[model samples]
Target: MSNNVLKNLKPYEVFKYFEEITQIPRGSGNEKGISDYLVAFAKEHNLEVIQDEALNVIIKKPGTAGYEGAPTIVLQGHMDMVNEKNQGTEHDFDKDPLKLRVEGDMLYATGTTLGADNGIAMAYAMALLASKDIAHPPVEALMTTDEEAGMSGAMALNPEHINGRILINIDSEEEGKLLVSCAGGVRVSVTLPIKWEDIKEDKTPIVIRLRGLKGGHSGMEIHKGRGNSNKIMGRILYDLQDRVSYNLCSLNGGAKNNAIPREADAVLLVNKEDVEGLKAVASSWNEVLKNELKASDPDVNVQVEVLPDRYNKMFSKETTKKAVQLLYLIPSGIQTMSMEIAGLVQSSTNLGVVTTSKDMITYDSATRSSVKTLKEDLVNQFKLLAEVVGVECETRADYPDWQYDADSKIRRVFERVYKEMTGNDPEIVAIHAGVECGLFKEKFGEMDMISFGPNLYDVHTPDEHISISSTERMWNYLIAVLKEIK
Candidate 1:
């Protein structure tokens, strides 16, 4: 099944390895199977290997004949991929392999994410390791797990296990750009206790839904000014407060802290007499939002539907007010841009997930900044907001930023190789998105690193895909760089 799709692809060895990888279920936090596969590959090739408790794999290969005395080079990429699928996709990420297909110059999965972000890097590394002809220094292929959820695998890796002074990170998304630096970040989770009472006899139950937003990676597309469904839903509820009396029953939306919320829905009990008024308010906002977000979210939708039976219970008036206020006030997009690097986002927060249960309503937010102080300040802001709303707040998955190195030799080598291969100099820039390189820098201060990869679009979402021709070019560029390394 995989052969027919990849038969015409160049760098045949790399694509073969990639197809094999796609068959294994390697979603973040579920990487034991892929980790074992790497171990087996290393053994099959008679290479030295280490499998850590965190499931990070390190495979070592001696240098080629003439380059035996050269410095060891580390090729790094994460083993796990973000698990995302379309609304009605039936494939299970835990056991089913990605359904692969080719479209023009790009490769994608049917109704799901393609996982080419870092999987291609793993394929490149494996192909290089299995080669007997490509010239290179001592190679260390480091594969870490759970990079999408957090940098857990990289955080747990011991610096002593690696001796390489030069590292090439293959986890970037662009085709002709080199990622020199990235933001540090942390996840903040807030829980607010809800006080619920039986629904009043004179009230009616209705559901308000905000959908059709074109959501993307929070850090990558936050500056695009797309509508956040959770935030929009909050605005509708807050605005309706003055015209209609409603008690919150349930509010839920979004799935991950890294992806923007594409849809959100809320259930409420409203005075029977004000049902039509609430629907009118929702319709009015729908038009306003469509106009406001037409450029970035042309398909923005706001819908209100009445329920046949009333909800058994709803939040008390005070709790409802607090919930609405918190949603309205929490920061949801780019907060500031970089002063040092023009057009770069310096600090931001994403209101990623919102959910409500009988006992509590919880919000999950992700905050990021290239500056440590600014990152802390953004986190503090969330903490203060949660405190004001009388909710419990905690932060987790804190990772450091990968600072730019002006004197990096590896960056220069990659730039030179890229120019020679494509007749154009690669753009060197920092990204707002978080990468495992940050954690690697924190662990190994002496390591000089740069990140580059083939073109991948819409990562962390169902529209994800990789450019086939770009992958071939990147493969040749990497081989050239390896041969030039001293």
Candidate 2:
């Protein structure tokens, strides 16, 4: 094959396919175009492909030469990427392709995510689909959907649709590691009523905006000492209330529960006289937080800007006090570290999203862990907190955790294969975040599974990038294992 056929093909030819797929918009819940593209590519290669009702596409490649009798293996990954961006970026994920750039050995986007989490897996599958010379057993490519959000497609998967007993999930972020277990997750939302009172006293609209925090994965980065904007904003408001009389008008921060809140904004109607004092307080708090979170979030910015107009109907005194109290009392960040796995977080919660409307102010929180009892216990803790704060709590989309299976045959096979290939033992660990493996295991009981992937750093953030050399090594390792399996 000519090198020109693979335009940006570096050490790993699969990255070229990944680059092509990056040009197409494959955000969660909007994967029709990408799914169609995959189907077309499969048909062009004369491969047998099936598109299920859920838009899941499966392409099957027959065994190569004398390896026909070898057991089949299913290669799985999601087709969608999380649409997240930085504070002041003007990139549209739907219409524009990912602006990929290479710095040193890392491949990243200009102002958006590089989409290598599953894009690499999709590329690897495509490479397997297109390759004819590589010797391997029967191959089945299962491209799932909506994995970043809630594992909607995986949960919806019918076990009767797939035939492979062994599945290799290529979604782990780190390299040289095998993941056999992952945490479950649940999103809890608290809605509180607003009591707006007409302000007899004149007040100015002062915006307290929290930005420049290095927000990261709520699960993996929770113990890394980064500050949550939602929590910090609550602390600021709680302290400001003691010093000055302010009305909470509007507050907004964060979008997804799995990501730490980077930027938050609150428009508060404060007494005109206290503007200078509030600004001074904000500056002092910024300095304090900068010193505290510099190890994790170096650019912690907290600014208070004065606005010209006041809120149409400011909050009554009673409502303002209660709202600030609730914000201070909400539980966020890592609650407890795991006892089973040393240095692993067992339970954590994030106050990710906060929004204000004319009628009410609502805050969204998500709690996650590998232990089911601990996860539920955290939810109940939040419920009690909300009750004392006088807010209605609601839970949604609870997913099962993939408990660690010590006797899994797939893990043993991967460990042996990795040790033989690299001459060093790979790290085996259980993650605190949720993966589709849990849902798949629930559906297909007794299915042998393990997840591994190339080195992907800063996932779900604008800083997200993947290593080209690591990807090449990963491909070689996977091919070696696939050929070794009988």
Candidate 3:
């Protein structure tokens, strides 16, 4: 229970469990280790536990003596964390544990994500399930998988597995806000055919590297005007087509579909005479990008890497043109703002990834919208663009938006408890990002749901961290809410 990184932290039990879970790598599409660990913890406490085929773990505990007949309460959160780090940081998310560090009131991972998004949820659930003094109704801890890239884990849930009508989802980022509605999203990918050609004797290869932009959660921070390196790479190529003759080898950027692209690298083969000119152009463009992003992404830059030896391969001129065209023509960033709510974004898209393979190039985008028709419209818009450029488009891991519930009993309990404890009313909010509450509503219409969490900043990015004092307040609030539910 005592660790140097978070030693003697308030709310000892929650931090203890959080530190333990951080030692195990739980990145998206890789939840077996964390899931099994949850099962072990449940068994150690002599509690009933079930793990589904998709690696979603559910642990059940009976109610206290006084609340044996109270309706069951379901606590849920995702198991996966967005795996991101500083470009040069040496850490493998699949195997290495997050290196925890404390800075004042914040908890951080050295040069990487801290996984506080939902890891704190698991920590809180573990603390509650193992405690002998807390008063509450029967508890069902639902830990799902792959909520970072997609909501596949939540979508794969079986109705029979969840018996609780009142659900508390501990996945919100803000401490005092209760989320009532959320935007639905889909992952759309476009694949284009490529033709590789041998390096020509007269060509010179130089890599254009884009870096230093502050990429963030596409849903949470899309309105901040942060640069998308994939889009910038496309813009550079499209603009330089008239000044220099070149063929592209590859255009790759981004690590996750739900995060804005922070850096991109593109290789180009140009006429030997145009190499110097290209470098000059890159320098000017770098300055331009910095100036434009002074407020949003001040460190934005572009570097030209000239190798001592000639490159071995390059894409054919036809394939190069098609690839550049796709990058240039496709749209990204916030698409539309909500007219109903002030300062709310209605629809947006993040062109998060671009990768080159042996025979094809793929562009992955995460599109979100609170309105079903608008979500369909944006996905269809991407497909139309793909059709024009002779590329294939496909959608996967789609999830429904959670609508606001005005008559939610769980929400009323939260609102009352939070006010009684804080002497102020908690803010009722509708988020643009997706949450599992929407999927649960689809599966169980009568279920009452609400989401709240500690203060987490810069999620889905390397700068992610959680507040220490906020965690204590959240823990106290959760216990108070649970006791009131009975």
Candidate 4:
């Protein structure tokens, strides 16, 4: 089954490059293949290109005709995509190409992310660079790596390598909305050691699983009030501690540090007689959870299954108590709402992933805020929570926020062109999620920047998709903006 549905799409060159990109695996931290491919494309087109040590690619194209004297414009987007899939998708993002499909006006992949968040930016840049008729200024197309995991490529870039003073970032998700600023973020990891013990006499093994929740991008969808599976499991375990005697064997959930967890599972050893009681408790909690999240997650499921084989080892009673307490106490979801912006989320955290190993259990979270002091405060909060439980916590991949520029020349050009084309003004606003524009601004203080993209839904999740008609419209709008540049 070839995922070549874009062959007959309109705006042939844009979709053509997108189709080619989808055939390559370019997940974060594994972008060498795609970076090399971009270099090869530039070479084939007889253009100047650079592939940095961090695998970031920059392709330079001369301006066309009368536009040769115009100022150079930088077209920026990341080459990496978040690799997320359903529980049993059987697809390997590190090796297999995405399985693309078209339904109505949208394009999506089977049981996985479509990567359109930034991939379409690369496609648009490539198409424009390869064109001979489109009027534009000198172009520098910058494709970065490891952006989903962190802004490592952007962080590694030297300011001297880029000469463009006007930058247009192609990483936003909504159409007709120009992003002027964005929040900063960091990844936090906490580890707690536990002691293991032999299971007591006549104890049975059982598994509790939560699934079917509508997980989404942690930063963008945090305010949606959807249920977090890890949090749900914590409540269940806390309730079971008083009703039934059990020993925890293993606990795990979630994949990315930037996505809300949709599924979580736990294994436990309980006395044979307590199995039925645990099931009843799980059922009761399921009903309660459904009622609590009915408006957001209508399809949430909670299941319990008993195993024939018994587990030989389990966490000590003290360890079990501390683990449950940690999950219950740690902060997750929206922490604050913007008082200035009408409906924007100000500060937030996602308790993204949890895992257990032989010596320790680890919790990974992503926190974001536009205020530098508030972002640091959230990290301190996480550290304090871990300290109380005698665990260790650390932060990584800290990126700065992009502040809005009220006097940006490039933004004015974009707004003027959008209104002339659509007969309506585009909404200009700031986003809560992290974008690479912040790193660019830090490196080049005088550069003017703005971010925009086509309409996309459920980004960073399995249900991610891009609208075909909106993509064509965005392509036209980008071309119009380029023509207006001076």
Cα lDDT, model 3, residue 291: 86
Candidate closest to the true structure, highest TM-score: 1
Candidate 1, residues 57-156, lDDT tens digits: the string is: 9999999989989999999999999889999999999999998899999999888888897899899999999999999999999999888876789989
| lDDT score of residue 41 within candidate 4 | 93
Q: How accurate locally, in lDDT, is each candidate?
A: 0.89, 0.84, 0.89, 0.89
What are the RMSDs of all candidates, in order? 4.1, 4.8, 5.2, 5.2
TM-scores of the candidates in the order shown: 0.82, 0.78, 0.75, 0.77
Residue 241 of model 2 has an lDDT of 77
Residue 383 lDDT (model 1): 86
lDDT by residue (tens digit), candidate 3, 1-486: 224577679899999999988888999999999999999999999999999999999999999989889999999998999889999999999999889988999999888999998899999999999999999999999999998876788888888998999899999999889987788889999999888888758788789999999999899899899999999999998888888888998889999989999999998988879999998887689778988999999888899988666778889988989999989877798888877556778889999999988888999999998777888999999999999888899999788777666678888999999999999999988888988888898788788889999999998788999999999999999999989877
Q: In model 1, which runs have C-alpha deviations exceeding 4 angstroms?
A: 1-46, 62-69, 80-119, 130-134, 148-151, 198-201, 243-246, 270-280, 340-342, 455-469
Q: Candidate 1, TM-score vs. the true structure?
A: 0.82
* lDDT for predicted candidate 3 compared with the true structure: 0.89
Query: Which pairs clash inside model 4?
Result: none
